[model samples]
Target chain A: MSSDVKRLSLILLFSPFALWIVLLILLPHIGMVALSLREKVAPRVYEFGFGNYIDFINEPIYWNTLLRTGSMSLLVTALALLIGFPVAYYIAKIAGKRSRGALFLMCLIPLWVSDLIRAFGWILLLRETGVISSFLIWTGMTDHGIEFLYNDVTVIIGLVYTVILFMIVPLVSTLDGMGDDMIEAGYNLGGNSLTVLRRIIIPYAMPGIVAGCIVVFMLTAGSYLTPILLGGKNSSWFTEQIYDQFITRFNWESGAAFGFLLLAFTSFVVWLGLRLSGQSLTNTVART
Target chain B: MARANTSKALLFGYQAYIVAFFVFLAAPLVAAGTFAFNDSLFPSLPWQGFTLDWFFNDTEPKLGMFHDRRLLRGLYYSFVIALMVSTLSVAVGTTNAFLFVRREFPYKNFFYILMIVPLVIPGVILGISILVLASNVANTADDRFGIELEFLRPGLFLVVLGQFSFITTITSLVITARLRKCDLSLEEAAYNLGAGRARVLFTITLPFLRPAMIASGIVAFLVSFENFNTTLFLVGSESPLTITMYDRMAKVGSTPVLNAVSFFLMVGSGLLALISVVVQRPAPSE
Candidate 1:
């Protein structure tokens, strides 16, 4: 009797959570796919077909937007890699115990902010008479105030500012577990530092590097707020197009197709990341 | 030894660059926090005279900068919704964390992978799903059950549900990461000490898990509070604080008060994280 009661109680606890996920997370994704195939008419009837995919393909702006978004994602991913690798190395390799926690907290602060507010700050920084321009004028970098906002350059910088932490956390955690012994051995064997890095450090952190790149890519690709706020109308990205289709034009079909394609793309990147590392994100980083 | 010295020089040089890079990475938050007290509303050129008026403008008659009624309301709603979602996520997350950590179950990998799909899936799709499902269920409830469930409407409860969908996965991941190293020997010791199974878990193990639980809970809260993509879809015009701010910004680009609000929020989140870090009890590791 006690066993049955415990079983009943456990089921009661687990079922609601499971049901919530199935209904919200799993089933809704199914609905997105369904919504993609279904054509919405005047009186709330969705006629189901492959018309949406066809329309999506027929749209050049959509493909162009996807390409632009993809490249933007790549740009940010590359910059974050260029920017994050050494910091992770330093934190994992050099920082004292007392300061490491504080350093980690610094990496996390920007991450915890609202992306909207973060983007707004970029707008505030990059605008025609904004912070960067004012600084330029003060330092006499330019004869007149400069306008940096609403361009690809600002968008790239904004995306980098937002998504860099996704790169750092994984990289630092991965690198932290790897000791200095191998590098020391390499040096002992008369290999130079550059040689050691290219030959050993890169390979050691490859999994984390790959996982971090994938995460940064997915975030930059799926990002709407940064590009929307900073990218301006001329700086059109795929997510911006998706937003237009759904909210402005009231079209769900093409929007769903666009959304699904983005999903498939990110899923492919994640799968590729898993394949690259042959491990989960946790282990890929510094082998914790 | 000479080779080590040469390599050490090189690594230190690289570390110098890294220190600079970290400073660059941390610039924005510090900048935003700095300008929160700026007398100037905009981030214009020339360090506009600094003042604490932005923090104290709540008293003026014609739009007190500091005492923004709308902004404060939004912040309050954000806190409430975040707290609710965090609690919900932690509750569910703890269950899944327990399941994954403690015992072998049927199709364990399947359930594990199945549970974390939302983590990788775009928040955009996740948002759409919650919107459709909640509305559909609400529709059916009104039709069949003759009960209009306002809580399930596109508001607080629905927002919590949407945020919790993915937030639980994060909380679960963090807790599970800690749980794998929870040293089941402790539980075994408790079991041997004339304690019941529940007693062993609650008395012996739960304290050990508290730090992770608290950290994950607070993180889940922050994620929900800042969440925009999902909330955008499900918020139904008057949803929560972030939604309200977004709507205003989207329509009219909002006021400088928003900057004040954002600054305050960033400070609030920073303090929460700092306190969490400090209050975190050091659990003896395995």
Candidate 2:
């Protein structure tokens, strides 16, 4: 092909993808950033200012909810890590070949369903007249059906349950690469199980751990459905605040500001997680 | 001897833990699936006689979910949106994968990373951003060019756009992974044989990419069909299956029909998951 034709073909092939990235991803974020800076001055008028961000800083309710959401997300990440690590270890290291595939499949299947359906499953199991409450009552554990839904505890459980697979998938892949001989070698060398786990296993899995934690933290922090459905009125999830601002109040400026704040907050948390875990973001994301 | 016994005990304990974990993971799904046949109006216990009323009932008192117009409409909308989004995503994603993997350009790494940002961004935030951006564009066009883009208004088109914006990234990544493993020699040999660039692409490159394209297309469709967070903000009047399901669960007390929906989804996705595992399974000799 001639150079001009080659160049033209390159542009032709590249423009759509380039336009997609620029128009859809980059421009919208730029729009959001611009929207975040402005404040509504009058009807149908928006003026550039930091007033929207200032409102977030000044309102204790807003920042408090953000902090609460962040902390709750942290808790969920930790719990998912706790529950997921052992299962991942079992599947990756201990299970026989056939059982390994089956176990992994069992973990993978739940993730295929929508988060809404998964949250609904939790509601069916935890509601006032739901299965767990009914089981407790029938077993004489309670006099009447207990309302187990619509609490922070329920929200945390739902969040952990929802994101645990994210944690496990990474951990399993990471652990699957680890050799059992290492563990056996550590035992033979008189290292206790805990010592080996702390020194060898944990270090080897740090990339996976960081990746899983980042994903779980981000998902939990920004999650709207599980918190709203399972936590009900008390669920002060920050994404709900963003939703309320955008959809409910029609305050695009405030919503844009909150959206940026969430992006910043989650990004910072992820960076901090990587820093603490001594994992590079590129490596962690690659593992994921 | 003592160490061996202790390790054996630990193995047993870990085995029990795994069993308990599976139970924890599976119990909620089992509970939900159970109510699909419960014949009870509510999804909760007190098992009414086992019946398929939720799946097939046509009468007024307890019409099956499939017989419900609103739900069927939602399902129709979901499928249509999924179809559009998957087609668009696959086309864009396949092209981008070729560009990223085969061709080099300035700021390629930067654009690649930028594309990945959408994947990690919360779907709710992504929806809001696109909604804001598209609405602004529509307003600007009306003010300046007097052209009202009806598609920009929240609807199936917007939903498809919202979903495609992020899902394309996933599709591209899938294809890119496959492309990385593909041998480029075959294409080079085709070119050496006097095959034109387009011919080489069609006859060699595309055939090699068919599996990745199909797989990613299926994934894109599934992701779009089940999307709620992004779709919720962008959906103007038409509620997809997920949004409809959420509405029923939240506003109206969900019935066994919802459980029936969940059952069908589980079965469908379960089969897909099984198929994927089987397809991905390594050869026995290997």
Candidate with best TM-score: 2
Residue range A155-174, candidate 1, lDDT tens digits:
89888888888988888887
Model 2, C-alpha of A138: deviation from truth (Å): 1.4
Residue A200 of model 1 has an lDDT of 84
Error in Å for residue A284 of model 1:
4.5
Clashing pairs in 1: A174-A285, A174-A286, A175-A286, B57-B66, B58-B67
Interface RMSD of each: 2.8, 1.6
Task: In angstroms, give how far residue B226 of model 2 lies from its true place.
Answer: 1.8
Q: Least lDDT summed over 10 consecutive residues: which range in candidate 1 chain A?
A: A279-288
Candidate 2 local lDDT, B227-255, one digit each (tens): 88888889989889999888887777788
What DockQ was computed for model 1? 0.50
Q: Candidate 1 on B178-256: residue-level lDDT in tens? A: 7887887888788778898778878877877788899888889899999988777677535567777777678866345
